[model samples]
Target: MELTVSPAPHIHDNLTVSKCMYNVIIALLPAFAVSLYFFGIGALIVTLSSILSCVIVEYLIQKYLLKEKPSIGNGSAILTGLLLAFNLPSNLPIWIVVIGSIVAIGIAKMSFGGLGNNLFNPALAGRVFLLISFPTQMTQWPRPIVSRWNYTDTETGATLLSKLKEEGSQWIEQIDIANLWIGNQGGSLGEVGAIALLIGFAYLLYRKIISWHIPVSILLTVFLFSFVLACGQETGNMQNIPMWQYAFDFALIQLLSGGLLLGAIYMATDYVTSPMTSKGMIIYGIGIGILTVVIRQWGGYPEGVSFAILIMNAFTPLINNYIKPKRFGNHRS
Candidate 1:
């Protein structure tokens, strides 16, 4: 037999795209279930429509548009659909869900040469696109406990974080930490439930689907920075409350009340979009965390997670370029 020489990374593992993507889908189920339990028919309709739209779009693009083999079998389209739906209002019109799915798979994913080649997270790009174009429908969040069966005609309400933005720290009186944790607040399809998102985060960590670097970095940065901001202020609500307690509550609200957990755990850590090295991931995460707090506190929007992630996604290439592993026999440091 002839001898052959190949480049390094000579070892092969049993991992497949199918297994990895399916595991992610599995990990997302806890949050998805919470959305169903709270939003019911609305959630189901949006999810199915988004998934179907994404799958069909990818198939057609590969078959006819690109004249290449279909890649939807890898479940990237399905995953994109689920994530897009997660980032959207559950009561959004079915046609809008279709539009978002098309944008996710067509423009964000396929247009960039498919899965591993995309520069931005497809779901979030789709979300930002929808948010900018249809701000009214996208921002209308249906409150929980209204009805499981109600999809469209349900009463719309502002989220706690929005109230915080409008009414200042005083709105904290209206928000119960327990209700927010249990997913009874008004928000997007999957982002309202802190407990469910945490459960999903735990599963992803346990499965080794993602490392702790990105998520931990983003969360810790948000907490520490927000604690500093809280300590500098003297809101009346915190007068009687201990300083530490008030700061903790303020940071916790920043953490739990929006898509921070969702973005930190799932969206920001996307394999193709995030940094390749631990150091680079940390930098990426820190940027996301700081930008999120800045936007939440000063920017016009009440929530800044999706925008923050997309913005950081733009820097991922620069991060990877500057922070790379040492060469095999050319270590300079």
Candidate 2:
């Protein structure tokens, strides 16, 4: 009888890419619902347009360019679309959202071999591209829902950073932390509501779609760093620093403002782009937190989470290399 050999058995994990992406989309629903509630139908319009555009583009690209069966069914494209939309302003034109989706799916994702192969987060890259390409539109924040909407008028309102940059420490004293937390303040549509983002985060945690290491570390790092900064200003013998009255103002402004929550919980934890090891995740989170604070405090941008996340994404490989988990009974040479 001839010897018979067979290929090794293939093991499958229960968590498919589609399942992971779908869970993420489901997790984002609370934030989306809250955004629609606060920002009107405009947010919904941008989100839907982005999702449709991304899925269609992905299908076409896979069919024609790659000559492979389309993976849009996997829900990665939809996730990218939602993330790109979330990064945008509610008042941005539909055409801008289309362009953002094209950049995200076509250039950032497909060009790099799609999904798991891309080095940088496609949504962040697209957002950054739009920021550079359309500074006026990207930076021109809409007034909170309380303000009347006028389609023709694109009057500029100050972001938290813009206010700080223009008015210094005095500007923060005038802000309402409650409004900021509850999504009644002026910022990007999805980023406005801290409560909504946290609710979504809790859902993700409950579902186990993401581990708690990255989000918790990033938030803690930012909180601790900002706290120390506030304390230093209060009693560190720096005569030039603002009065102690402004310390809590500074910390709260840093905590409950801009894209910090969204980026910390959602973007930074991207499964493929982030590291695999727990230690690496912690390091990545701390790196992003420190960079975010540094950029917000001293860099030109008022909000720094996007840049911080992208920068940390670039270092994921190095982090993984150094922070590998030890194998069972393995000894280091």
Query: Highest TM-score among the candidates is held by which one?
Result: 1
Tell me the tens digit of each residue's lDDT in model 2 across 53-160.
999999999999999999899999999999998998877898998999999999989999988888889989999999989998898776766443443254447787
Cα RMSD (Å) per model?
Answer: 1.6, 3.6
Any residue pairs clashing in model 1, and if so which? none
Q: State TM-scores per candidate.
A: 0.96, 0.90
Question: What's the number of clashes in each of the models?
Answer: 0, 0
Model 1 lDDT tens row, 19-93: 778888998898899989898899999999999999999999999989999988898889999999999888899
Give the per-residue Cα lDDT of candidate 1 at 243.
Answer: 78
Model 1 per-residue lDDT at 328 = 71
Q: What's the CA error at residue 333 for candidate 2, in Å?
A: 11
Q: What is the C-alpha local distance difference test score of each model?
A: 0.89, 0.83
